[model samples]
Target: MFQGWNALLASVWGCCLIGFTWGQLSDSPDVLRNWCLDSDYHKPQPGPEPQLFSECSPWKERSCCNATVSKLIHHNVKVWHGFQFRHCPPQVSSECLRFFRRDFCFYECSPNLGPWVEFEYARKSRQQRFRNVPLCASECEAWFHACKDDLTCVRNWGSEFDWIEGTNRCPENAKCQLIRDTYADAKDFCETVWDNDFKYTPDNEPCMVLSFDPSSGNPNDNVTEAAISRHMNSINSMLNRQRIMERSFSCRISPSIAVSRGIPKLVCDFSFREFDKMRQLKGKPKETPRQKKERKQDFSPENQHKALRVALPIFVGFWVLIGIFIYLNTRPKH
Candidate 1:
């Protein structure tokens, strides 16, 4: 009984699987047909074929009574009528009929049909051999104008608000302001606004800078630049004030002569002197060793004493050697 139950379950599952597979296969065409129901999706239906009849009847004449005559005069006008006539022959085949049905369905019932049928298979053939034709200057100019307008709109929208807002248009709550200022001031304002929401700076000396060129073709150029400028200036001024308040405490530098006499000072002085010399010799070539050595050297007493100690020993040794050589020469007679 368990084995029978297992068999029944297996059969039910198999049937379900088969049904699912069949549904999957059939649903594709149904879905496509439903999609074709949309008004925009148009496809042409296949046209009806014209009917043909024989001009003369078989019983009209004795000649028609002949088998060959009957065969010649039968419905041979339409090839689908089969080759019952001798003068005309039917070219119809089972394969041709199947092909025609399929071809008709594809070019008639399918969503791609209108354009395909209007252009025929030549449409696909042309697309396959498509060449990238260069646009004329006029065409490019027109496209550029359209692209420029779109880009301008996008830029305006992006600048006006954060992306959270759906519409590209600016919110009514925010008043747009414009200020013209030096590049430096403008940069300071922008930086302040970005870092600390709408702050002022010492550079808050705002100028009325035009956001868009009034002379340019943009219509939005007429919009009040002053409002934006004031907002920017206010932010800049706030930031500037904040920065000033933060730095209000004076920085004290303790007076220390010892620090002035340090290695850093020596290095700085030496570098400064060298820089001055270089400047003096500007456009002049470097001096030779002899020219450089011509400068007077100021030796301190200690340095002079050290130099004397080194030279005195060498001088005394030279004198002793000379005397010994003279004595040896004079004593040669001994």
Candidate 2:
């Protein structure tokens, strides 16, 4: 009876363990499953995988990156040059603006395959950045096509589409130098680079970041300009601690902007080439080659002669008047 009872307990425990294992296996996320099938479907080779996956070449014509990018572009972007700023007031702090740009790019530009996909692909390879070149190229190409129709989008592509290094073609990664903050060094001069979390902007800090919850499969679902505006406005008010710049933007989405309450003080210290591009957009048009040639021609002998002709009579009249005045003074004095 003792031997039979012990055997029965062992059998029941074995069944429960097997059932739990099966449940876990069946519960894999769709994104992870899709990535495995798409990215890792191929058989392993003896050597390292190629930096550029030529197998994905067939996907070039298919806008694979479109779904990922449009998550932000479709809603956050207004007609070409504008953003869904109904949530963000013009008086909002610059920190909120940096947050807006960073959040948009982080979600949109990130490799659609999965997180750390770039790092994984490049781990065994010498050129890590080149590991997912094909995918990167495809994303850039898709953005180029999407923005081609809008002048403001095209012009601001440097900041707007800077994820793929602002071009469809493979570009050399720019090396960035970390500026040593004198204020920081005053506390302690450490030889090792400090892991300064505070130095990072809110978008860079995941704890402070507010990402758009993209609905599954359907990029358009729950994504609207009004929704995006409402979201941004809420974030802006939370960060605008001083209340000096906490006015909300007006839009049909939210008729009255409410002041954010009890949010942690957040600072915006981020700058992008895109901001400069926007400033340039507002500034004077660039001088074209034709304009430069015309300007050069204006200084030519022929043009100089025409200008001199107009000025010679005035110059001569002024000298004559001066001479007459001198003569009159001398004669009167005599």
Candidate 3:
């Protein structure tokens, strides 16, 4: 009776454990899909800095195993807010600039305003591949004329604001329309905003003189200039980062190819290869049916002996328990 009871308990436990394992194996596909979706679909964020190459130089176009290359390729990096406004190609309507201004400007552009920019992803393929396309110059000009004096247009234009409230305050329909349509309108606004002031501002302007005076040996002036230089460099770095992000999102698989068009030296020479190596270290390859069978057969002979070596102690303990139970039951009345 004791032997039978011990056998029944072992059998029940074994059956339940096997069933659970099989259920998990069958649901593997769903698990994998969920995992991929979680890991791949979201906005890319800044990751750990890649290994830097000492041999690489900014002036010289050469390749080294820098981790920044992968981040740039994947568009998982950040830059200065001011970089977007730099190097505007006159009369050329840039889709990159347009999209960048529309979506990212509120966060990165002006600090004084609130969120008011109304932007949507362009559906057309030509617009998506916007390089230096022509924009609505006439509409842009007309809109700029009306809003040139309005505080919101001049001060809070590129910054941020409530769309409904701000639009209502605009003096003219054209001003509201251009401001809402950010791409071409933004370019025209930026161009004309400072145009009138540039000619009137004399060389001896107090603010300009203190900042640009070469002979000023004052320590404060030197410090200010150095700070300005660093700020400019940061903006330049952000510009490069922006280019890579745009290209990566635009062409997910082969972003390097698209980005390399403008930046000849930034060809992803080793980033992908390094990324693959990193993946292989962390990722396991799925086994084929034949491979699974081979793995199962590995339990024969020496493997069986190895298994017995481990199971022998557990088996001994089980029989000891059964023997004690039988002894306890059969003992004389006490």
Candidate 3: worst-modelled 10 consecutive residues by lDDT: 108-117
Model 1 lDDT at residue 301: 72
Best by TM-score: 3
Better of 1 and 2 by TM-score: 2
* Top-down lDDT ranking: 3, 2, 1
Question: Whole-model lDDT, candidate 2?
Answer: 0.31
Error of 3 at 232 (Å): 17
> For candidate 1, lDDT tens digit of each residue in 156-266?
221333333222333445443321221124333332321221222222232111111223422211111332343346546644433322222111021133234332445
Task: Give me the runs in candidate 1 sitting further than 4 Å from their true place.
Answer: 1-298
Where model 3 places Cα greater than 4 Å from the true spot, the runs are 1-277, 285-294, 300-317, 329-333
RMSD of each: 39.4, 30.9, 25.4
Better of 1 and 3 by lDDT: 3
Task: Give each model's whole-structure lDDT.
Answer: 0.30, 0.31, 0.33
User: Residue by residue across 184-239, what tens digits does model 2's lDDT show?
Assistant: 33112111111111112222212122223332232211222223344346445533
Where does candidate 1 have its weakest 10-residue lDDT segment?
A: 111-120
Model 2 per-residue lDDT at 283: 96
